[model samples]
Target chain A: MDFLSVLQFAFVQRAFLGGCVIAVLCAVLGLFLVLRKMSLIGDGLSHVSFGAVALGLLANMSPLYVALPLVVLASFVILKLTEKGRLYGDAAIGIVSALGIAGGVILASVSRGFNVDLFSYLFGNILSIGNEELALAVALSAVVLVVVAVFYNDLLAVTFDEEYARVSGIKTTRVNMLLMALTAVTVVLAIRVVGIMLISALLILPAATALQLARGFKGALLISALTAVTAVVAGICVSIALDLPAGGAIVAVNLVFFLAALGFKKAAV
Target chain B: MSAVISAEQLSARYNSVDVLQEISFEASAGDYIGVAGPNGAGKTTLIKALLGLVDISGGSVKLFGESLQRFGQWHKVGYLPQRASFSLLFPASVKEIVGLGLLTQKRTPKRLSSGDAALIDAALELLGIGSLRKKLIGELSGGQQQRVLLARALVARPEVLFLDEPAAALDPQIRESFFDTIRALNRDARVTVLLVTHDIGEIGQHATKLLYVDKRVVFYGKFTDFCVSTEMTDFFGTHSQHLICHQHR
Candidate 1:
């Protein structure tokens, strides 16, 4: 099928829509994560969601429903462990990430072998996005974007200089909790599009790419969101056209943009 | 003169080590209180404790006549943390960084009003960086960055300002002018300035009061009084007079 004809399929439309929504959400949240030196947190939370998904599968429940609150809880733990003067800092993330993947593997094996449903979730399957999942993705993305927009200025202050932000009475703790929660929600929502292994790529690459090109925080966020959405669209189209893996293709698109941004930055300088 | 900040028997600890012990002092409105001490003298800890960044082990602090435990009016207080802790790698413009001060005053996510914009503009002009408002923060010089941070702190028109070694990274020329701007803020703006610095001698003349700290209040009194205090002589011995005559760096 041609590009337009391929996109006419319901699954293709769902994949494109879900992927773009998640791209925007991840890019916005990821910028703050990168700025706060917590970029790997997306990786950590994705692994935790993997474990939650395993638990859901074992219990015969909806994996997304089970992973949502579990991921949010994991966010709180990560935030708590990395608070000021916490010796473990990144180590805590490492432990949780390793444990999560291990737990997911153990549970998956104990459940009498990895099923196709679990495998599809492990790898990306753009063809599997149902209408209900599409609606949920759109709704959740709206929530993340609205919360971020409402607190953009405050979040920026906290991200750059948290100590100074605290003194400014920005309620650094509450703002941080909110950021972590939003990150958790985004990670959960992103799983259906990029799956476990490639989720962090979506969260980090676009923001990193945009930072290379923008001089202001607002501009960087705007560019990152655009970059992410474009990557998702192009990646999906390329995936459909070439019969390639959607997650890897999307990440490949993101990498290309980052390199292009680097060239742009160098030429401008 | 009402005390804008008053601490009685203040104590603090970090990583299970007592950094401050039974320290007490008061900063009245419009007063320039210069805090001086050796490295690890709890100078930063003292400021942090007062700023509620540190956990107070004992004693009490009152700001603007309210107990520190109930001191929620952060809009009236501004703090500039140690310069070394600041990172300019993030992409925020001078205007946006300074505008963060106004966002602190907001309890909700409302739009920035014209009045807030005017205040940010005034702060930039006051710091003589209105031209650089659109410049990226990371691209500025150390002095310019410090001024931008000061503008961030001052944009809200805080009645009391706490600065923790704000000039520690600036060159001597810039440091002198930094204090000059601070003096103007205190004198013209009628704001209380509590600045922690390594330059005891330079601040002696500009500051109305000097607080010599060594884990506790070694001395807290008028600058002239501290100059002539037997406590000053006793703490540094014969070098006390020489300490007062330190060469400007």
Candidate 2:
């Protein structure tokens, strides 16, 4: 189908809206994730989401609904473990991530109804998104956006230096917990467009690219959101034209934009 | 003279390693206390303990005669960490960074009072970086970045400021000027300053109290007493003589 014809389809429209919502949420939370050097935690959580979805299918429930709470729970556990005494942060992430992926693969193998449908969800099937899912993504993204806006200063201070944040009476621990919750929500929302495998790329690439072009938090957020939107729209178009997978196309577009930004920065210097 | 900070037998451990062992000291308001030690002598850990950045393994730390935990006087203390490795390459202007000092107050989003702006401007002026307010923090030299950090710490009008190797990366000329500015802040604003450094001779001249830490309190007394003490001679070894030579050179 032609681009206009694809746009005319309700499913295509829903998918595009879903991608846009995820893009916005990822772009916002990605700023902090990149700043705090926890971008890999996003990847880790997405893998955990995949496992949650598979477990949901086995239990005869809607995967997204089950996956949402499961991912949040897993993120909380990871954060708790890291915070408890002597557990190293990166080590906790790695251990949890490995187990999550393994559980997902095992669950998928034993499930009766698993097929290409499951495969599509693993890597994303934006064109297969429904109206309800789109609405859910939009609502979650709005809530996350509001939460981030309300706590921007605290998050900024915490991201820059936790010690300074604490000394300023910002409650660094509580802020960190809130940030992790936001990250979990953002990861779940992003699963529809980028899938579990390529989700962190969407989270990291746009923000990193924006950092190259912009010189402040507000500027970076604006440029990053714009970058994400551009990538989604362009990726959707290119995927439809070439009959390629939407998720891969979107990530490829994001990668290209990041490279372009890097080149531009180098040239400016 | 009221002590702004007082530590008694403060000990700290990190992952089973005793980073700081039984260190004790006190600093009154307007006192410039310089903490000197060799590498791995627990200098940074001692500062972190004072700032409550690390958990104390033993003893107590008091601020204004109350335990630090009970007082929870975060606003009264300002810290500039040793490293300035912000993820976003100086994405903030000097003004914004200094404005962060006001984060202790529960203000509404994007709302800056006229008083807040004036305070930021005053801090910038005090650090002599007023003209560089609009410049990005990453664009400045190491010395300038250190000044911006100091301004950020001072913008809140903190009673006690803890600096961890503030002049570590600055050029010799910039380091001298940085110390001069620090001295002026202590003198003019009556701000309590706790500085960690290896530059003993210069700090000896500038600081009122000297704390020589080597995983323990080797010596803690007046700077003059420390200068004449055999303990200072034994601990600093050639390092103290090198500092003195550099001052003359």
Q: What docking grade does candidate 2 earn?
A: medium
Q: What is the lDDT of residue B111 in candidate 2?
A: 51
lDDT (Cα, tens digit) per residue for candidate 1, span B66-165: 8877788998998888853545667888888888888767877845788988998999998788999999998998788888888988988899999988
Best by TM-score: 1
As a TM-score, model 1 comes out at: 0.96
Q: Write the per-residue lDDT of candidate 2 for residues B1-249, one digit (tens) a residue.
A: 557999998999987999888887888889898888879999998987877778999988888788878766666777888986675374677888888888776554635588999999998887778999988887887788888888889888788889999988788887777888888889998989999988776677788887888899888877666656675577567676446434421
User: Which pairs clash in model 1?
Assistant: none
TM-score of each: 0.96, 0.92
What C-alpha lDDT values do all the predictions have?
A: 0.86, 0.84
lDDT of 2 by residue, A1-269 (tens): 55687789898888788898889888888988887878799889988988888888788888899888888888888888888845877777887888888988899899857755567777998888888888889898889889899888888888887778887877788888889889898888888897889999999999989888987778889999999999998998898899999999999999999999999999999
Candidate 1 docking quality: incorrect, acceptable, medium or high = medium
